[model samples]
Target: MAKRLLFIFMVFILGDIYFFQAFTTVFHTPFLHNAYWCIDLSLLIGVATLIFFQRQGKDIQRQAGDLITFFLIVFIPKLVALPILLTEDLLRMARGFPPRNIYLSEFVLICAALIVLVIAFGLTRGRHYYRVRKEILSFPDLPDAFDGFKITQISDIHSGSLSDVDGVRKGIALANAQNSDLLLFTGDLVNNKAAEMEAWISDFTLLKAPFGKFSVLGNHDYGDYTRWDNAELKASNLDRLKEIHQEMGFKLLLNESIKIQNKGASIALIGVENWGKGGFHQYGDLGKATSALPAESFKILMSHDPSHWDRVTLTHDQHVHLTLAGHTHGMQFGIELFGFKWSPIQYFYEQWAGLYQKQGKYLYVNRGFGYHGLKGRIGVWPEITVITLKKSVS
Candidate 1:
């Protein structure tokens, strides 16, 4: 880890040095040049400080997130402009050391400036810019009574990182406005501590549905990321988090299944604990959750990570008609416009955002309800997903 970080630091420094030439060319003022170096030095020092504190075993999760945000805001624009500046330099070298291309340097600066404005908006307004994504899923085996069952799902609250009460209230209010038949929260309710959710209990409790609200834990709920004085303390923290879920009017499901009945017909709702691939803990038992159900039961499974859908749920003996998850948070940054969508998180999670189907089973990965490591969202806004299940004609 240390070696990788060192390599990254060296790359950052080299990139800054190369990009600074363009900065100097675009602006001839001595004051601006001094200001540029000052910001660069400050960021480098900040990185060093974070590394030192981390090695000392201090819990700097929040600080680390802030630093990452700063790095993106400062470096992404430079990265975008690097290729253009490098091309200009190569052309000049081929032409026998001619004068620098002032026009190209100016253009690169303009592009970088525009990117800064976009990043600024993401840091300020994008964090709370909630978007509602609706999908209509058709299942042939869906019960007639559940032909139009609407489900509202929000995931990865990470309440510890939330600071704006009004912003949170807006999201909760929006979720309630959907007026779905069932409400589900695929979790990360807090960031490693139960106390993070104390203030938001009332806001979340307002999320209503005609059927009921149910939830399943995510990887972050286990309190494994942070240090605890003892095992009992960590256990107690998780216990308290479970109680918070109940207080928020959500039935916390831990590897359990329940039947939701309407008009004398029913569909199964199964929720398992946080089970993820790539070193994530395997606490969920799919067989135990569906032990009492018949093979042909119309089931909607709630698992926190979408990887579960591919790794286990798809191949399980009993088929799951639909699965809802929200762990990737769409990497809190990406471009989604004009029917095109892309995010860094996609490489890590096959089913990162939106709807995915395989072998006739459906999985919808929510972007997330709250921010985490980056402190703000860019193109991938916070999400409130509403899925309508319809009975498909055979």
Candidate 2:
């Protein structure tokens, strides 16, 4: 068992190395020029701490202290990240975008990912729950048809890393404050197993949307990253996670459709299994999923991958009007300050975060509510998107 765990750990660490090398090759220049350098320092601290953790005795308390520090290491960079995202001045005044080929922006995304690796290392070492950061996302102009659409969106929760339901109550409170019209969870509900949510099953029930609550799957939800000797067991775990969703007042939408109707005005919510350019998520079949929607009316897709908007969705399909995604997690890093948007993850995801429109189609890539791999949220604090369906006013 230990050997398997170690092998998994090595695989992840090596993947990080490859990511860094590939990123540098593309950008070929120093990152961000100024603020980007901080991540470089964070990386150095990460390397030194990793070696320290490996050498430490397996004593639980000593290990616990290390876990806390691991959280800190992951958490601090986000303070830098927050300034870049929320502060109006920082983003607007910031100069330069990532160079196209080898874009330095990607490096920023890669560095953001490193924080997760560090946290996952802690979890692999039996560490969990360093801290849970609470974030509120209030969107502009919620449609009158859906006024007070207090939708609670929890994305990239990565439940396996959660030691306990630390911020669960606070998060619920935040969600309730908006008097949410609906609650939409954008995927990554569990890190790996269905059992992980056991500790906090009751907590999620606290979140109730007047209309209803819904959930989708994330990359980690499939448990593909782990080596499962029995495919049946893996499949069973997924089924169980669905059961958990049902238990928590959520309707798990897997390549299915639902109707949100109020005062006779209705919008169709179409959910397909995760779909990405590569085989990241393969179950999304728009043809089959949208079969429920009539030839007309608006349809919003809850697909985990943003690429689906470009690769498969934006056709004259007419059935799909909006795509809501969250897998990129804004690379969980970057600055949106000073009226300038900068994040390395953007190169891979043109619609990495916030509202985007193209070819008359629309997409809202959420920043996510819960932090993944890492313990803290930086520039792109987890978001709860409130989308208002506006008339073209044409």
Give the residue spans of candidate 1 off by over 4 A. Answer: 1-17, 29-31, 89-97
Q: For this target, which candidate reaches the highest TM-score against the unseen true structure?
A: 1
Q: Score residue 89 of candidate 1 by CA lDDT.
A: 74
lDDT of each: 0.91, 0.64
Instruction: Tell me how far the alpha carbon of residue 77 in candidate 1 is from the true structure, in angstroms, after superposition.
Output: 0.4
lDDT of 2: 0.64
> Could you report the Cα RMSD, in angstroms, for every candidate shown?
2.2, 12.4
TM-score of candidate 1 versus the correct structure, residues matched by position:
0.93
255-329 in candidate 2: lDDT tens per residue? 888889877677778777888875585777888888767867667788888888888888736546667788987
Best by lDDT: 1
What lDDT score goes with residue 282 in model 1?
87
